[model samples]
Target: MTLDLIYSTALLLALSALYEFNIRAWGQRLFAAQVCAGLIFGAICIFGMLHPANLAPGVIFDARSVILGVAGIFGGPVVAVIAGLMAGAYRLWLGGAGALVGAAVVTTSVLFGLGMRVALRRGWAQPRLLDFLMFGAMLHIAALGWFLLLPMQHLQKLLETLAFPYLFVLTPSTALLALLLNDLQEQRHAKQALARSEAMRRAITRASPDLLFVLDEDGRYLEVVSPEEHLLYRPLTETLGKRMDETLPPAEARRFQDFLLQTLKAGTPQKIEYELDTLGGRHVFEGRSQALDIRVDGKRAVVFVARDITERVKAEQDRRVAAVAFESRQAMLVSDAGTVILRVNQAFVDLMGYSREEMIGRKTSTLRSGRHDAAFYEAMWESVRKTGKWEGEIWDQRKGGDLVPLWTTITAVRDAHGAVTHYVATMNDISERKLQEEEIRSIAFYDPLTALPNRRLLLERLQRALTLARRNGQHGALLFVDVDNFKQINDEHGHHAGDLLLQEIGSRLGRVVRESDTVARIGGDEFVLVLEHLNEDPALARTEARQIAAKALLTMARPYDLEGLVYHASGSIGIAMFNQAEVDLDLLMRQADEAMYQAKHAGKNTVHMHGG
Candidate 1:
């Protein structure tokens, strides 16, 4: 019985080793692990029963209760139920006087283990050495009660002989199994915690925008982690274990090594600005370094974080250039898309006579002169919107309430999406240019002495009148007037008297004709008049010309006072009428001149009609 008991106890210990090293290594699925544990526990229980410490024929005792009970305590309800049914069914199938008793013992041991598990979970009992020992003791005590089912003759002998051995061997085995399971639970928890911490570290490094590096005291790259790989000096695999002098220019590498040594000696954080020609392009970087407490490859190390500032540096340079250009001599103003003034250069302030503070935040319409109506501004802005530019003359008011004409060009500033973001306007004061242009127009198309249309202007109006006469079926007349004895008056009263007589004659001719007619001084003493929109008939047009000629002849015969000297001058007039645009312009002028000569031959201070 002692040797059989050793064999049974040794089998259960082997099962305990399998549970420790083999079953638990299947990993962390609790239900699947417990089901596998249940199958193993049931198999161990059957093997133990087959080699039981036999007291009598068809009556047995071994470690079946120990296996099922431990499965209940550690594997919870699933393992306990599965293992108990298997062992209990096998025991009942082995028809014997102890079969019922063995089955009852199986149920009682399983129930006690499950009850203790509930105690541990609810904090009614702690899973300590004392609790597990007491649990094993109490479970065996209950299993002893199932021995009453044995035949009364065998039951007393079995209890007296085997009860002590069951308690001695299986109780400590149960406690040892619980201790093993507890240790495995702690190990699993620690491994999961370490895995989660490692995953978090990797996630943070992958998401960082800057390049992270570990460099040894000798300036060799120990490790590199770059989220933007293109910004790196080289690929990570090629860069590791490479010295700074191998990747950078000699001067730059020396500067970097000096800063690294300084950081390590100080044992504190250091900062630097540097440049590197990288895979992408030349880049400017700002680096921050902290000395590490550990070593890499037997040398002290540092954690260096580099942030690329290439675009930022370029933008700063561009901003400085734009600042200088914006303060130029040309008057320039910038406004938002809503026409609210944003910025104005010094030249703009001087030109508009408004202080920068007064103009900023105010609408551009605040400087409007009101000479242009709303429709004019709308058209100007429409051109700017469609073509992105508008240039014309505009009148803007000064601070003193005087209108200043500006030759202004407005250009729309747009963003990358082609949306107008602001408007930049350049202006030049054109007041002096306007005055010069008016003087030029007077000299080009008008007589300087009399301020009347000159011969050049007269011919243009005569051609236009001819065009109107043909279109409207109207006849136009041209009158040629001559000062009678004008050369004799000039020889008697000097040239000043002749000039005054010509000026008075020009005024008198204007009064005798309609406003639409053209009166011009073509030569020294000759004048021509063009009347438009006259009667359609030839005789009626001649009568109209005769009446106007008679009026002008009488007015010119009136005396003129030349510098306090009363001077008398008379005029002879001739008329030529035409109703067709096909009439030759030079031929028509000759006809009027011939008629005037005939008038002079007829009598002085009289009028004559051509072909009369």
Candidate 2:
């Protein structure tokens, strides 16, 4: 039995060695090779070449427990189940008093090994050498218990004679095999890890854009790895194994040596910026050095990576200059090609009352005032595209939704290639200046005393109304009104009372006309009322014009209370009607003036028709 058991052990050991030889070729592939192994082991068990010890006429001792247990430990549940099924089914086919016991042995061995695998994987038990021994011992101990499944009389005889040596030899041998396999598996993993690490190192060296160099404490070049040879001032073949001072200029060599010393002393990393001449041009480089634990030729070394940053440095300087201008006092905004706002200045926040977070990624139309039509914007952008810039008054709404007027200058910021990458709009709030200009214009063209359009504005309106009336084949009239007895009120109540009377007259005349009509105080006690859009009926237009002139005269003639004094005033009005056929503003004014004298001569506070 001892010699037979030894033969079984030799077969198991031989198979383990042979499988290890081709383990890598199988590539794991999820039990592709493990299933083949399980089948071979199952065939060996069935042929009885491995079940070498006969315990009784129908009972045998074999390493089937070790085979399935090893499968469970290494091949997981899928492998264990298939292998156990194969061996157990074939054993049942053979049929004997010990067949059921043999099947139970296969099931229990796989179960015990699989349970240990799960516990180790779940960290319920640590995977150590002792854990392997304990697991292997469990599989064989379980095999001993399967004897009860056999006939009680035969089991008692085997237990009395062969149980001791069977357990003594099988238990340790199972543990020894498992330990060897686990060691071999660990060694295989270590070799895989080393190969992967070496591959990663080579990949990093090849993929990096920066120039890398390995240097000793004496600044001798040990290794140079550069993706682009044009970046190096000298060829690497001539510089390898030579001191930096021999290959580089005196100043640059001293700079490199100093950097090396600093890295070695600090035993950390350092950074520097330097310029070197290359075949392309004088290039700027940013270099970083890290102290290495490695030694070359009995000397400590450091690794240095130098990256060209000439264009990057120049761009940074340009950006700083632009930033100063971009963040100036004016409200400014910048947008991408699609007109989505990317940035806004501080002044924009203050002017528009919108925060950076609220505006970025939003369209510029968020602040649209709805004053300009779409055609206006289209034209403006077309101009900007053509000229690369445009300056004009634009209207935009504030964050509180107020329509704000702006004097904006937009510039199409182009890239070096002259492509419009972004648009910058610098705006100034022109609302206050516009309000001031409106006030100045009002003073220039309006009567200060009555806040009515003065002679200048009145003439302008007359010209426009006459031109429009002619174009539409309509009639417009001009009423020349002189306040009757206006001098009497000024003399009795002083000039202040006279001014008040004129103001009252202006208000009354304005009320009698349409909002589109104009009432102006040309001077003291004299004013003009321009009536427009009297329709196409010439006679009816003349009748309405006379009635309006009469109504205004009566309003002015009514008594006015001025500074707690009752004062009386009246106006003599002369009406003149014309169309585009008589389109001369000066001739119309003369005709109206001559008729005003006719009204004064006819009778005061009366209306007279001109050119009659």
Candidate 3:
């Protein structure tokens, strides 16, 4: 019988692997998977019986109970019934006096195994080695009890020859296989679950945009994970296991080493910003570090995330400088390459007696004063074209049609390509002072040229609006407005007249927006509108921003009586819609600027919306 069951343990181990291979499919149809396993093992059990070493002419012995009992315990009632049928039917077909007893053994062992399985489900008990030993003994006893189905002589012969071996060897082997198979299944599942967890962690890390690192308190790199490899100053192999002092420059190394230690000590995150000379060139990086639940080389571990913020810092500095310039006493106007006034100071508004909006997009001729002859104006522009600057005294007409004398300087701003991208014109009043102190106070937070909020004030107000909108879950709009063909006025009518046109455009923008909104001059013919307290629905809010833009378009399109010349002008408007909680203000401004260029490309006098 032992020879007949040769390598049965090996077969059982192989079945453990089979169960694991189809574990997912089994999860969906556990009963079916179980029934299939039962049928396969049951057939193998039948083969084991067929090949059993004969103990007598009519009686036989094999480990059929091992297959049937295990199938029942692991697979439940359905598996038990199927496996019992195969084992019992094959035994009965063998046609011997002991066949009935053989069938009985298979059936009873299945029932015992099923009882334990149901008990496990009910939480009454857990499987124990002693219980399996008891179960194996009981199955043999059941088979022995049916010995009456054998002839008296056959039963006596079987008992004397095989009873001791069956009890000591077969029963113990059955119990051991059952316990071993159960452990194998559990271990396989544990490994599978662990694999899934690791995959999920890797997926999350891969999805992040920031540069990530794991390091020890001693500033040794443990791991580096990043979507953009160029941001890393050192290659992966070079950084891993290397100290910061070895991988980075002295200053940066010290900064990072201290940062990691501080993070470990605080047990909370710390933020820092530093610059690096990477393969991609110099970049400013903002980093935040948090202590991790780990230690390496007897040191606490920290997780650090770094993001590039070079462009953001540069843009902020530029805004601050522009803000300071707008707060100055000189009436200043900044125009883009398209000749549209992009910003202005409040002095221009007070000097011209026009609200900042009125003269924003009007031709420079609007303030011509008719003092300088056509030849004189041509010479001024020609000189600016060649020298990038022209400074002189001139007469400018105000909103009330009064001519005021002023000293002015116009400078051309060029990009790296040596192409003129902007013009900055500053005016210093030469006439007698009038309300000078009051003027200074009035223009404190306003552009001296347009009486609109200066850069500093506009940013504060915008930040507040954004916060309010976020709290209320509402929307806001930012517009970057450029006057189209504005340089034509400066070239033909004079810089003074171009300033007048800008004033007109600015005034019209103010008229079209809601009272709660803001219209401000950045410089030149460029204006910005902060439309606030808008609808929560994105589509509705977008429509409202567009409606206001259309109104500005129509209003600015009307002929302007710049010194009664009746000049026609238009606007190129770019709009960026945002929610307070989500938008970065710098990115929002860039979106608007990009949209404005889109409008310029689409033909001026139209509006363009930017996608976030």
Candidate 4:
């Protein structure tokens, strides 16, 4: 072979090697580049054969446009134009009548390339069998027209011999090869689409928070996402390939088994609600199962997705509890860390005689009375700060300027870290009980008629005085007094007038004694005085008793006007000094009573002393 033929043959071999390598390494989807390289090499072979000095120009074929046309249809315009240029330039260098024919082939290749380029620019380069056939016909027409027009007198017999075989054999073979290449390209594209779909499925399942699992018809776990570690707490590896009962608790596993069986039998999706224990807490999951047409690994299976609803369930329970608490009848107040009232229920507002707007944002101390000092509050806080609770009676003021007594229990609400966040106080009003207690005290200690302390209180005070005098080694005295001619005043002015005179006498008696003395009514028209810390001399006691008796007599003697009726009254006084011989309260009372009898027996409205 000539060097030019040898070189052209070598180029063809190199192009074929490149096409095979691209098909093996990069797959058939990128086969357009390989096809372009083959067309260019074929064009170079044709140019070399057309040169008489290269190989006598007899081996050359005028159908080189077919290869370039195929490249144009498949590999697009750029590859076609490049292959045509190489073929036209080699033919010119070879110097023959076929040079014109090669130039004509180049013109057709360029036209096809430009036309394909325009079509591609308009988005028409996509593979279609109709367009392929049209391109093949165009290549045949162009090559045959040029061949028939060529004037080669000596080559007519050779052309006739070659034309029939080329038209019948090479054209059909090239068309079949082009169709096969298109089929291979389509198969490669389909394989790529399937691979992408599988990759997308894997990515979606791996990233999903919801648990994705599959189980067999007999309720054995078949496949799971990331099927090694625990999705929540239970390891999927342990559960895999095991029967449902062996993997989970008996009840839960049985339920899952039943769901799987139902889905497999019915060929429809099934849903089940079950509780799952996780690191977060107990969660409620809605599991949906469906019979899968294809098994993951050759077992009849059901695919399932479990969605968590733990927060929604917990929120529903909390809402119910809050509803009950909000409608509770007891007076309740929720306060902030600083004791500012945040919420006050209807009962609290009604009990405290305040509106909701008036109470909220107000400090609890707004209801505090000056009765409890700072020490009392400090002790309360000491207990609260230590134990997170304080419960006691609090004297609070009402809006109407009346004291409201309440028994309150306060609890400190804390967060997860045990920091005090708020305070919840429940209060019960005890105002009615307090009022009743005051009424009972008044009835027990004060005389009903005179509003003065009765003899019961007087005896108690006299005993306290005796105790004090004994402790200090000091003298104390008790004075007993009786109204002189109290019956005569009743006889002259009726019992109403006598009652009025007695009220006047009680007032005058109170005026006669010092503020430190205890004056009490022992009985009708009889009174007692308790003298605390008196002078030791018995005569001084007598003198003080006589002066008080004189003052009382003068005040009572002047009170004669009563509803336009005139009346008069006087009193007799007796004084008894504290002594070791008569130290007890009863002895003091007896001695002072005997002295008063002595004074009355001696002269009315006079003063007398014991042991005189």
Which candidate achieves the best lDDT against the true structure?
A: 1
Q: Is candidate 1 or candidate 2 better by lDDT?
A: 1
For model 3, residues 1-612, the per-residue Cα lDDT tens digits are: 554444553454455445445545566577678777777767767766766646676577777777777777876777778878988888888867677778888888788778767766687656677777877787777766776567778777767876776677657766787787678677867877898899998898888777889988788888999787778898777898899999999988987888888888898889999999887788899999999886677778999999889899999999899889787877888777666776667877766677667666755656688878999989998999999999998888877778887888999999989999988888888775535755775577688777788777788888888888988999999988899988899999999888778777778888999899999888788899999988899999999999999999999999998777679999999999888576787888898999999999998999999972
- Where is model 4 poorest over a 10-residue stretch in terms of lDDT? 50-59
Residue 206's lDDT in candidate 1 = 82
lDDT score for candidate 4 against the true structure: 0.70
Worst 10 residues of 1 by lDDT: 16-25
What's the TM for model 2? 0.59
Model 1 residue 491 CA deviation in Å? 4.8
Instruction: State TM-scores per candidate.
Output: 0.71, 0.59, 0.46, 0.53
lDDT of each: 0.86, 0.83, 0.80, 0.70
Model 2 residue 186 lDDT?
85
Off by over 4 Å in 4: 1-323, 467-476, 489-496, 511-516, 533-549, 560-564, 578-582
Candidates sorted by TM-score, descending order?
Answer: 1, 2, 4, 3
Q: CA lDDT of 301 in candidate 4? A: 87
Residue by residue across 361-460, what tens digits does model 1's lDDT show? Answer: 9999998999999999999999999999999999999999999999999999999899999999999999999889989988988898888899999999
lDDT of 2 by residue, 1-612 (tens): 767776786677556654455466686564676776566556655554336577776687777787778778766777678778898997787666788888999899889878877887789876565776677666777788888677788778778866776677667777777777777888999998998898998789879889999999999999999888888878878889899999999999998999899999998889999999975779999999998887888899999999999999999989998899889999999999788999999999999999999999999889889999999999899999999998999999998988899999988989889999999999999989999999999999999999999988888889899889878888889889887766676677788877877787788888988888899989877899899889678889898898888788777767777768777776688888887685678888888888888999987888888877
Query: What lDDT score goes with residue 451 in model 2?
Result: 96
Candidate with best TM-score: 1
List clash counts for every candidate, in order.
Answer: 0, 1, 48, 0
Compare candidates 1 and 3 on TM-score and give the better one.
1
